[model samples]
Target: MRIHLTSVFVDDQDKALSFYTDVLGFVKKTEVPLGEDRWLTVVSPEEPEGTELLLEPSGHPAVKPYKEALVDDGIPATSFAVDDVRAEFDRLRERGVRFTQEPLEMGPVTTAVLDDTCGNLIQIAQSA
Candidate 1:
């Protein structure tokens, strides 16, 4: 079976949506009310009908600790493959994105990490 959805915890849904869409260029797929918070999801522009990335609320007890652990370890909550790591990094930076790690050669890939401005670091990578 194919994976249909994945989640990434975010401190604020609105901010996360803005960053993911306006800055990173993903398109919103769904936004449904779920009790106090909403179930928000986005998809890549290049793959509109592909798997969704859920922007889960960070305050949820089940995910709080896991999110914290990932941030503490400097591990990105999610990664997006790019055509050119350096160009994407530069473009993102020009759009006011803050990066935690600069582009670096990593064996078979060139990668960089940036703060999503919501709660977690997101990685951008390209084949080396």
Candidate 2:
């Protein structure tokens, strides 16, 4: 059993595409237009054939409140694994990305959270 795809709601696909690719370093995998919305997805550059992360539209009525509540409680919409949390955090910070939480160690794991700029917080983590 293997994971195929997952998604994160975005306010704007184009903007999210740029951020995910240019900043977050993911590569575009699929893009099929569907009027006001599109079926877009991205994959980690290092794992281009791995699980896909869909850039879904936040048009659903329930999504707004769900996202808001998560943000209000300082929760991440999703997490991505990194080789080194602190190094990744510094690399992103140097690119002008805004982080809501700095890297913190928790036992054998370290994590940091940052705003996705598309109305969601994303976490980067590393484990020993």
Candidate 3:
């Protein structure tokens, strides 16, 4: 089988939408209200019909500590593929995105980690 959707726990949906869309360049795919929270999701503009990334709320009891531990350890919550890791890194940095790890090459792959601004570290990767 194949993946259809995945999620990143966010402190605020609106801010996450802005960062994921305006900065990271993903486009909104779906948004449905669910009481106090919405089922918000985004997809890469280049792959509109592909996998969707959900911006889930961090209101659950275990969310905060889990997210905190990931951040404290410098681990990324999710990774997105890019055509050029360095170029994407530079572009994101210009838009005020703080990166925890600069682009580093490992064999045929390159990756960089950046804070999502909504309590998660996200990575951008490229493969040769």
Candidate 4:
């Protein structure tokens, strides 16, 4: 089966949407109100509706700890491919995005990790 969806836990849905769409440059694909919260998803501009990145709420105790543990281990919740890691990092910095790791060469690729502003770290990578 083809991969069409993935999820990242977020403390707040609205904040996550802003960071993903406004800062990280993903496009909103779907947004539906779900009682107190909402079911939100985003997709890369290039991919459009190809894949959905679900912004799941981290209100559940089990999910909150798991997400936090992943962050503490320096593992990004998700990674986005870019044409130029350095340029993308700079552009994101200008938008007030906080980065934990600056662009660094890693063998055949260059990558950087940044805070999503919603309790998750996201990675941006480019071919070397």
Candidate 5:
């Protein structure tokens, strides 16, 4: 079996949409309103039919502390593949995205972590 969909807990869906699309360069796939929240998801432009990334709301009580702990420990909530981690990091930094970790090479891979601006740390990686 293969992966289908995954999510990142967000504090604000609209802001997350803006960041994920306008800045991170993902394309919106679905948006169905569910009362005060929506089932919002996005996909990489290069893979329109691939796995979708859901921008789930962090309204649950446990989510707040869990997310906080992750942030406090400098851990990313999720990672996205990139052709070049350094290039992607530079491009994103130029757009004012705050990075917690600069691109670092580790054997066959390189990675950088950035704030999603909606209460999550995201990593961009390039693997050899």
Candidate 6:
């Protein structure tokens, strides 16, 4: 009845791991070798047992164009909830994260979009 695992296609697993952990503050949960790729996943530090975010490889032929089109239209590959959008945006900007869209507030919700550095636009959102 609840969500379990989800994934974001990545161009490089190692780089994605670094960005997701060192930069975004997620922690590695599982890493299992699977032929040419690994079944790598990460979970929020605050929610160690929560849903896992898989760092899947973008080796499929259809993935490139799908990613490109999403980027071209300024769409996020996935969104992550944050306590405060502006604060998170500032923190991420200080770390040299490139944002396609700055924090914008709409009623009770605020959001910002940033490039994942692995071929996807990711969004950080907050709701008041």
Over 4 Å off, model 2: none
For each candidate in turn, the TM-score is 0.93, 0.98, 0.98, 0.94, 0.98, 0.99
lDDT score of model 2? 0.96
lDDT of 5 by residue, 19-99 (tens): 999999999999999999999999999999999999999999999999999999999999999999988998999999999
Give the TM-score comparing model 1 with the true structure, all chains together. Answer: 0.93
Instruction: Report, for all candidates in order, the number of backbone clashes.
Output: 0, 0, 0, 0, 0, 0
Residues 18-54, model 3: lDDT tens digits: 9999999999999999999999999999999999999
Clashes of 1: 0
Residue 119's lDDT within candidate 6 is 99
TM-score of predicted model 5?
Answer: 0.98
lDDT (10s digit) by residue, model 6, range 10-122: 99999999999999999999999999999999999999999999999999999999999999999999999999999999999999999999999989999999999999999
Candidate 3 deviant stretches above 4 angstroms: none
Which ten residues in a row are the worst by lDDT in model 4? 59-68
Candidate 3 or 1, higher lDDT: 3
Cα RMSD (angstroms) for every candidate in the order listed: 1.2, 0.6, 0.5, 1.1, 0.5, 0.5
Runs of candidate 1 exceeding 4 Å displacement? none
Could you tell me the C-alpha RMSD of candidate 2 in Å? 0.6
Query: What lDDT does each candidate get?
Result: 0.92, 0.96, 0.97, 0.90, 0.96, 0.98
TM-score comparison, 1 vs 2, better candidate = 2
Q: What is the lDDT of residue 45 in candidate 3?
A: 93
Model 5 residue 16 distance off true place after TM-score fit, in angstroms = 0.2
Clashing pairs in 6: none
Which sections of candidate 5 miss by over 4 Å? none
Q: Give residue 51's lDDT in candidate 3 (0 to 100).
A: 100
